[model samples]
Target: MAHVTFGGKPVTLLGNEVKVGDKAPNFTVLDNALNEKTLDDFKGVRIIASVPSLDTGVCDAETRRFNEEAARLDGVSVLTVSVDLPFAQKRWCGAAGLENAITLSDHRDLSFGKAYGVVIEGLRLLARAVFVVDSNNNVTYVEYVKEVTEHPNYEAALEAAKRAK
Candidate 1:
């Protein structure tokens, strides 16, 4: 179990924490079109960013930053997973003009949240976390933000992706 705080209040996570050397767990999340997308679907380096909701200020900023990063990175897929509905995700992406970072809806089953160990048990939201996976589906970086509202280390994650073996 992982401990995280939201609004300065304690929150417990439900799954085991993933490490840099661990095999990345496969999870199924819905794309904006309601198509099921799994970890295996993506090839090459991937940055899997988890957030509570896209509507929140912190989540918004984080996703937007990743979107910008995604635009500049080559052979890398940036996926922002949230608990919002598919329609809401599509709207948010369109409104935010996120062309590179894919906003994935994990509302159907929260599979991504649980598998990634970002599930906020009390709020039914995912904790802020960043994971970098290589072409072979091995975790190269894992960051479980201590606070739900805090920003992850984008530079570190990007570096890990670039250094992925």
Candidate 2:
């Protein structure tokens, strides 16, 4: 597992760490409507972003940026996963005016977080990371942000999504 920090303090991440060229793992998460959704539910090129919480500054900015990029990236689907409840996620999206990025809640179980190796042990939140999976479900790019409070490499993830499409 890769070393990560939350608020400058070392934190342990749980689950199998993903890598480039590896097949994307399938995990269940709740949609804004509280509907159960899985990896297979999203098709085509995907930019899966895992954040500690959508309420935080970094996570908010990251998701907003991806939501904006999603409009420009043809055939790419951007999914944001967090531990926030589905209702809260829905309210946040509405208030933020985010239309493109689909926010999924992993609170019911750390299904998405653990499957992607972004679960922050003891925090019940996901570590900041982004994964770009191709149409074939092969991971083409992966970025585990070292600091939980920082934004990810948006350009790299966007570029990867473009390539995937």
Candidate 3:
């Protein structure tokens, strides 16, 4: 279990967080179109899994920032994972005009959140995390935000993705 904070309140996350050297576990998540997407589809690119809550302000900003930044970078794909429904995610993206990265929903299985060790047990929400996976499917960077209310170390994660290539 991992301990994280939301708005200064400590929260516990279920399952184990993946280490930098470990091969990321396979996860099934739903795309904005409600299509199933797995890690296999993103085999050869640097991937940044940004877990967020669309209902929150910090998460909203994080997604927007990464969406713009991730679009400009080549050979890197940013996937924002949330528990929000597909319709809500699609609506939010359309309203925000976010195109660089993809927003995925884990409401159906809740497996992605658990597998990623971002699921908050009692709260039924995911802890904010930024995981960077290299082309070889090795986890290169991991930041389980100590304070969910705060933003992630975007520069560090981005650098790790770039350096991994």
Over 1-165, each residue of candidate 1 has an lDDT whose tens digit, in order, gives 656798899988977789889999999999989999999888999989999999999999989887787667788888999899989998998888874458898888989988888888878889999999999999999999988898999899888877875
User: Model 3, range 81-160, lDDT digits (tens) per residue?
Assistant: 88899888888888777744588888888877888888887877888898888887888888898887788998898888
Task: State the TM-score for model 3.
Answer: 0.93
Q: Count clashing residue pairs per candidate.
A: 0, 0, 0
What candidate 2 gets wrong by more than 4 Å, as runs, is none
Q: Which residues of candidate 3, in runs, are more than 4 Å off?
A: none
Task: Write the residue-wise lDDT of candidate 2 on 1-165 in tens digits.
Answer: 978999899999999899999999999999999999999999999999999888988889999988897778788989999999999999999889884469999999999988989999998989999999999999999999999898899999999899885
Which pairs in model 1 have colliding backbones?
A: none
RMSD of 1: 1.1
State which candidate, 1 or 2, has the greater TM-score: 2
**Which ten contiguous residues of candidate 2 have the minimum total lDDT?**
92-101
Off by over 4 Å in 1: none
| Candidate 2 residue 98 C-alpha distance from true site, Å | 1.4
lDDT of 1 at 150: 89
Q: After superposition, how far is residue 49 of candidate 1 from its true place, in Å?
A: 0.4
RMSD of each: 1.1, 0.8, 1.5
Ranking by TM-score: 2, 1, 3
Cα deviation of 90, candidate 3, in Å: 0.3
